[model samples]
Target: MTEQKTPPPPQIWPTLRAADARALIRFLVTAFGFEETVTYGDGDRVDHCQLSWPPGGGLMLGSVRDETDDAWALQPGTFGAYVVTDEPDKLAERARAAGAVIVKEPFDTDYGSRDFAARDPEGNLWAFGTYRGEPR
Candidate 1:
């Protein structure tokens, strides 16, 4: 008998409707290093879309309507996402060039990591930091 292919791991996808989803997808890819997996929608409304890092889940973007109650879609400028990176300084520079507002300059943390944060056009926060502590 032939073996069936295993499905990929499930991911928590967040939906937003305050604005166009395509624009967000593009930003995530270029700024955050996420890859656009797939998108679903019509001429002007994006029903849902998936985005992630090359190897696995990172982020998902989608659209919403007045009838929907997804918490993620309700708040446009109040959401933030933190991600770890190996080069916080370089990522900060890239983010600045991509038009993201630099909310915090790169700084070393007591936790032994160089970290910095930025805000996108939609007000989503992106944190890039490097881990400097040895494994316990």
Candidate 2:
């Protein structure tokens, strides 16, 4: 009998565009506790940026391009993400201190998770929560 081999899981990373990529990078670091891994661009013009959250996870971003006709064209705030955190309240406090727009204060859900929602400087929605979803 032959043994079947399982394929590796796909790698998915959320990509976003920011009006002020430099400022956005700083905001993400100060507020969301993301550490910069790599950034490409000169001066304030960021062509691409990558950040790593402590322990695990990462995100990619870049400055909004002027090309409007391309399929990759996207506006600031077009993307939203839900980040898993061990401490939602602490994260919320840090985000608030860094001037993130708090759309919803930290609250407990009936499903037994603590969560909060906030908007980035460019208006992208971010939800931090303890919930990891259900396993199949």
Candidate 3:
């Protein structure tokens, strides 16, 4: 009997809508250490942007809608995402120094993880921790 090939696991890429995408991109790189991979559109209107986390994974974002364009846009802080990192304290410190809003200081979780939460310039909540979910 031939063995069946298993399908690939689902990828989770967090997407956010920023009021000022141009500025938000800069903030994300400086504060959270996300490197810009690709950006679409121009000027103040950002159609899509892909950023690479320092460790792994990716984040996508776009600019807020204009007065007449009513597609789908999330208000800042309306969504939250967790990121796995090696140093939560250090990461939090870096973010704080870069002017990110530190919502929760780094702390040891009962689940055996050190984590911290912060709000981006556009008020997007982000959590960085030592906990990397199990891979399928």
Off by over 4 Å in 3: 1-10, 67-71
Ranking by TM-score: 2, 3, 1
Sorted by lDDT, highest first, which candidate order results?
Answer: 2, 3, 1
Cα error of candidate 1 at position 10, Å: 11
Q: lDDT tens digits, residues 1-136, model 2?
A: 5553642232457889988999999999999999999999998888879898775668899888887654668789888998878999999999999999999999999999999999999999999998866643
lDDT of each prediction vs. the true structure?
0.69, 0.87, 0.85
Candidate 3 lDDT for residue 37:
95
Residue 122 in candidate 2, Cα distance off native in Å: 0.4
For model 3, residues 1-136, the per-residue Cα lDDT tens digits are 5553643332678888888898999999998889999999977888999999866678898887863775665775687999888988988999999999998999999989999999987787899998776533
Indicate the worst ten consecutive residues by lDDT in candidate 2. 2-11
Prediction-by-prediction clash tally: 0, 0, 0
Model 3 residue 100 CA deviation in Å: 0.8
Selected candidate, larger TM-score, 1 vs 3: 3
Estimate, for each residue in 62-93, the C-alpha lDDT of model 1 and write its tens digit: 66466465544465555676665777898888
Worst 10 residues of 3 by lDDT: 1-10
